[model samples]
Target: MSGDFDTIRDASSSDEVQLVRLLEEKIKSLQIEIENLRKELNYYKAEMEKMLSPPLIEAVVLDVLPDGRVLVRSSSGPNLVVNVASHIDQKLIKPGVSVALNQRGSTILEVLPQKEDPIVKTMEIVEKPNVTYSEIGGLEEQIKELREVVELPLKKPEIFREIGVEPPKGVLLYGPPGTGKTMLAKAVATESNAVFIHVVASEFAQKFVGEGARIVRELFEMAKRKAPSIIFIDEIDAIGAKRIDIGTSGEREIQRTLMQLLAELDGFNPLDNVKIIAATNRIDILDPALLRPGRFDRIIEVPLPDFRGRTEIFNIYLKKMKIEDNINLELLSQLSEGFSGADIKNVCVEAAYMAIRDGRNKVTMKDLVDAITKINVKRNNMESMKERREKYS
Candidate 1:
């Protein structure tokens, strides 16, 4: 009977131990469920806050008031005196600084960094162009002069310093359309080992007041910051046109941009390591001020290639194509009289396409001749249409 009593107590203790273990597991599961619920609640609260808040708009801080307010120009509305957020650094709220506005445009919620104009930012060439000096066929003389003016100073500044003379500030490349002016500039960019910032002159003529001048200033600032750089302005005749007494707002604006450009060419902050290259097809109408010695220093004319030049260009293009031995480049060059380098390249490409279409592995002389004829007929038709349009207009 005593032994039976001891077994009963032992079983009771085992049952009690099992009950404690289950209770402990229930407490752990409840804690895990509570944590998951807390995360879900927080997520929904954040979403609700985001949906309830008004959107912020971009603004420019025109001035900072002594009373701790800011004079801001909101993107959509007129300028107004707005309150600044207490958490923002007061020193950052200065004139011309960008800022963010609250929904009502009456409060500055954030201090923003000055934004670079997207148009100006994209003008910078981050990657070096693939073109090299050897690849360009014609314009040997022009290339030589360009190298002396632009590349020599960057590569061997000591030469210019020892001579006690300032290096050339800018070079002007003028020629007819379809010439190799722009291509030559790209090759220079590749050889110079410097930053290339290319811009079209017409882009400087902005619609708003003083906007063009601002862009000109910013462009030079960027060039100066990126030392040992090259600024290539294509078709510069658009903004560098001869200044007249037209007295119109648009004309005045263009003149202002031109004046700004002139100042940058010979500015107070010396361009120690920067070079400027400009190209134009209409140099005849450019202002005399822009062509002066200090501004353009050297004026290189890229003329139509001669017969020998045409032959060299043809050889260069043919080397890249699967051309047959029967194709006489000299003869092709003779037939392509008055053709620019671009026109010659077009003919070569057209010939290659023709060969491919006819199920041929190599371009033939007959294919090249047909291509030339097609180009000539098309050119004549375009000229005729242009003449008719001019006459009727």
Candidate 2:
């Protein structure tokens, strides 16, 4: 009976030891799981904080109040009296500097560095155009005038200063479509070696209110920063149209943009090294304000190429073409009456296409004539369609 009792005690002791080891292992696993759960909880907490934070809005510093308060004008909202955060430097808070505001737009979160507006950055032309003065034909006088007005001012600033005159503020190129106005602007941009910013007047007609005017302001400001810059506004009539009281929101937006543009053109802020070149097909409809002296110093007309001009244009376009011996450029020029330089180039291109379609290596007079006929037919059809639309309307 004593041995039996001792054996039972030993068995109980072994079972108890095994149970204790199992419980230790279980506790270790539970501790590891708890640590993993804690790490996951920390990650979720950070994510929630970020999600709950409010977005910052842009604002401009209007004035610094005497009692640690700031007068800031929100870009998308009205003016507000705000308090600057402690982290931001006090010295940097001044008028005209842009700042970031809190969600309610009542607290100045931080002061932002003066940087080029995104719209201005996108409009900058980094690559020089391949078109040069030589490639342009029959606009010798126009090109010469442009050089004097646009290029000369940039190339030789002292000449103007010595002559006791401000260099021309801007040049306006107005003419029919496809008459090389844009090409002339390109040549000027290439020759002057100034930063070129090309923007369509219609681009300023934004859908949102105040956006158009803002863009215009930013555009000119950018030009001022990047001094020795050329701003080419194509289709000027879009924004330069005469303003009227009876109008839609779109029209109001356009008028606002035009007002901003006029202010920039002849504003109190002298456009020191900046120059403007505007092109339009409809000069008659331009506002009287825009046509005045101080804004656009010179308004040059780019007309259709005449007989002699057409001949020169033909030679220029045909210089590289593989032509048959009998193809008379003079006759082609005489035949291309009322054709613009752009039209003549298209004729040359169409003639080459004709030759290619015929599986030939050279262009002939017949091919040229056919191309001209095709272009004329297309032009007539376009005219008839336009007339019909007008008649019906």
Q: Which numbered prediction scores highest in TM-score against the true structure?
A: 2
In Å, residue 245's CA in model 2 sits off its true spot by 3.5
What TM-score would each prediction reach against the true structure?
0.70, 0.72
Alpha-carbon local distance difference test for all models = 0.83, 0.83
Which stretches of candidate 1 lie above 4 Å from their native place? Answer: 1-114, 124-126, 206-210, 268-271
- Enumerate residue pairs that collide in model 1: none
- Tens digits of lDDT, candidate 1, 302-326: 9888898888898989899998888
lDDT of 1 at 196: 80
Candidate 2 — which residues are off by over 4 angstroms?
1-127, 206-210, 268-271
Q: Please report, as a residue range, the 10-residue window in candidate 2 with the lowest summed lDDT.
A: 265-274
TM-score of 1: 0.70
Q: Write the per-residue lDDT of candidate 2 for residues 1-393, one digit (tens) a residue.
A: 999999999999999999999999999999999999999999999999999998898987756789989987788878899999999999888766789999988788888888766665667463455568998888999999988888888888878878877766888999989999988888887888777778887766743356888888877766654557788899889999786663687887788888898987876222256789999998998988998888876899999998888888888888889998897877888888988888889999999999999999999999999998888888789889989999999
